[model samples]
Target: MATDVRVHLVDDNTPFRDSTAWLLETAGFEVHAYPSGPAFLAEWPSRRRGDGAECVVSDIRMPEMSGLQLQDTLRRQGCNVPLVFVTAHGDVPLAVEAMRKGASNFLEKPFSDDALLDSIRNAVAGARARGDGAVDSEVLAKLSPRERQVLDLVVASKPNKVIADILGISIKTVELHRANMMAKLGVRSLPELMKVALGHG
Candidate 1:
């Protein structure tokens, strides 16, 4: 966990917001609480400072503006802050949508303080990794065009035989290209390769 992490907690419920903020502060984090999405956006410039906040914990359901809507708005505005959704048990579909839209994680309500903290820690690590400049265009350009295609397929979770079929190459050739791309990108894991291909972390 990052000792200097700053978190923004957005929820209409005052008690939940306050208690969660207090808990995070006690855990050595700097926390800001907002009553609504608009309120947070209104004060965002001031809240987003030099180092940037590590993560945002927001409720999935709210009046006027839903958490998913807020996530979309942030993406439209090019804000790359990792978002963690706090939702009710029945909101799993919404949580899944949020994840597909790049949310770091989702916590069903009635969750423990430890669970929230662990999720926030993971979000912070993801944000740091994304901003590390480990997957720049220069690094990507090192691969040949065929290698890039194979890499893209690999990052898309395609199997070696599938990639070979798609690219009209042999399975052994696909494996060789995959290895070459991984070596050139200095990525050792499928997730890391996906992050590089997706321009995330």
Candidate 2:
């Protein structure tokens, strides 16, 4: 019943998506459904918020891209949104692959609504814990003087150009430092990085 819990539902089956979305919504979750992995990816960037999605429920097999592919794509793009795989009876192996790639849980087809809701709750809890731990890692604590300066500028809501000018460095150099900071902190977006720097996550 948490208002902060938003779930993204990705599956190629229109009927499945609609039914699942309805169930989640009835259970008080904010749900968004996508017909395919590609469609989800297309909207993911613009849908991102400072806190990221609470959970992603996706099918393992689909047109365009499999659920594993979608998970990998999200990771590569620096989106650490918690993923949950929904698979058919015969897709357990694929679900395992999804788990190895950072999925929080896998719900087999024909699962009850209660089972699905419980899995999602667990995934959301895990995501919150991981996110908080990441924000406290030594990598974030051990920023270099320049990286700290760049991060401070970033948290100040300054553009790269402004940061470069203020720090008397080239814009490229500023960008490099910012990238390094992002990598060290395991954050993928400017807002996430800023949240870390501001100690709000």
Q: Highest TM-score, which number?
A: 1
- The residue-by-residue lDDT of candidate 1 on 1-201, one tens digit each, is 556888989999999999999999999998889999999989887878535447899999999699999999999998989888999999867876776577777778899998898778767754665466445768878999989777645543447865676667799999899889999998899888877765666
Per-residue lDDT for 79-98 in model 2, tens only? 88878888998987777556
- How do the predictions measure up, each by TM-score? 0.67, 0.65
Local distance difference test values of all predictions, in order = 0.80, 0.77
- After superposing candidate 2 on the true structure, give the runs of residues whose Cα lies further than 4 Å from its correct spot: 134-201
Report RMSD (Å) for each prediction in the order shown. Answer: 7.4, 13.8
Compare the candidates by lDDT and give the number of the best one.
1
